[model samples]
Target: MQRGKPLPQKEVAQRMEVSERWYRNLESNAGAPLTPEALIRLSTALALGPDERLALYRHVHANTKLGEPEPDGPEEARSALTHLLATHERYPAYIVDHAWNMLDCTDPMADWFPWVREPEANLLRWALTAPEAREQLTDWPRHAALYLAQLRFALVSSRDNRQLGALLDEVLADPECRRLWDEETKVVAYRQGHRFRLRLPHVSAREITVTSQVLLPAHRQELRYVLLLPESDPAPLPNRGERDPAQCRS
Candidate 1:
């Protein structure tokens, strides 16, 4: 059902290119599972944002279970995520698929974690393999184990999945990741979160509270949004609002 505004089943059906009755059946959840193509069409018609589209897909997925592994997020999902990330000006934020590949990130993220801007960047891989990570992350052992456990959970649906399997192989080849993979036997469910401190180069050491959050689509749960919130608001500096007199010469 259209939650708000003037949108009706007939209008939505026309947008989705389906008959009114068919759209009503979908609204009522009386129809069969919508194909991927149908989901895309419906998503477009419903004008769903990233989170809403994800919620819609999750509703569909509950009944279907894990039928197929989604390697990447759809264009709609990507746009929604990108739009949301763009809103974070001061803090670092990014989106990664289930396999940990960086989909997109805020500009500040590049300043904080430069490695994330690289092409085909993967969160788990970089965190485990990057030399700079050792300096950035103050508590590596705990975070690394959790990262490994999350990857293990991802591997469950991807045993035979070629792309994800290849990613697993690559991360497993790394010495640190391999050790954590073998040592961390427990599965850290999505709800449970962790925190870590990051000290960026040339910047003061600030404590960051990090957490992994999920945005699941109907096809499968793949996307995870990572946010870095400061442990506490920084103290206001003296002359905070006053501009430098030298800088006013321009």
Candidate 2:
């Protein structure tokens, strides 16, 4: 918990433009729940990283009273998220809502996976049901299992969400997807720095490896900015007898 500096509670409260007592109450979890804007300001004041920020939101949301209504899903991609996808034009980048539905994507991303332009496009559904996905992804089964696991995780958190329930039903309609969903018990909350391989003959004759980096917008945490950063060709492995010095005991 390396907060930026050892500032006093009063200083931290001043940075967030709140009263010292209110800030202290927030620290003790005795005050009213902070709004999203206030939470963002608090995170900034504390210099929380992406993981910590998400954890903070989850903790607060989990503690929300029974009568409190959950935030509605955004109808369209926020401008900030749209701009983020646009700016990352060189690599494949896209925005997905909490339900894993594709909201917007870059031209390169659309060119690579054209399904994003389809009406009500969903990344999980496409990855699980589309035949092309098997050909495009180097390790289809592993990725498919991962997508199903992530969907399972979402379903638990958003049990009342009609769209997510519908998405689950649609994917389960596929025999293979249903099998994977039932068999894969693993659950994934996020894909912060997941690395996977893609076979894009249109881009290159050989397979390409890209690491997925997830970014959460300050205002719209529900929307995830997924950027696929391409990795350079890996170095050749050494001969079997040539032991690496790093692996040897001192």
What would you estimate as the lDDT of candidate 1?
A: 0.64
What TM-score would candidate 1 get against the native?
0.59
Worst 10 residues of 2 by lDDT: 241-250
Q: lDDT at 45 for candidate 2? A: 86
Off by over 4 Å in 2: 1-77, 233-250
Residue pairs in collision within model 2: none
Worst 10 residues of 1 by lDDT: 241-250
Model 2 accuracy (lDDT, Cα): 0.74
Query: For model 1, what is the error of residue 74's alpha carbon versus the real structure, in angstroms, after optimal superposition?
Result: 1.4
Model 1, span 1-250: residue lDDT tens: 2345658789989998889988888878796458888899998887765444555565566445555766465777666767777676556677777677787777667656767766678777787777777777877777677666656555553445576678778778888778877764554435334555666543443454555445554653466666666666433444546432110000
lDDT tens digits, residues 1-250, model 2? 2443467999889999999999999889796469999999988987866655655666567534445444443544466677666577777788888888787787667756767778878888889888989999888989988788677666655556799898889989999888897775555678878999888665565778889998876545668888988897433334424332111000
Candidate 1 residue-wise lDDT at 52: 47
Report every candidate's CA lDDT.
0.64, 0.74
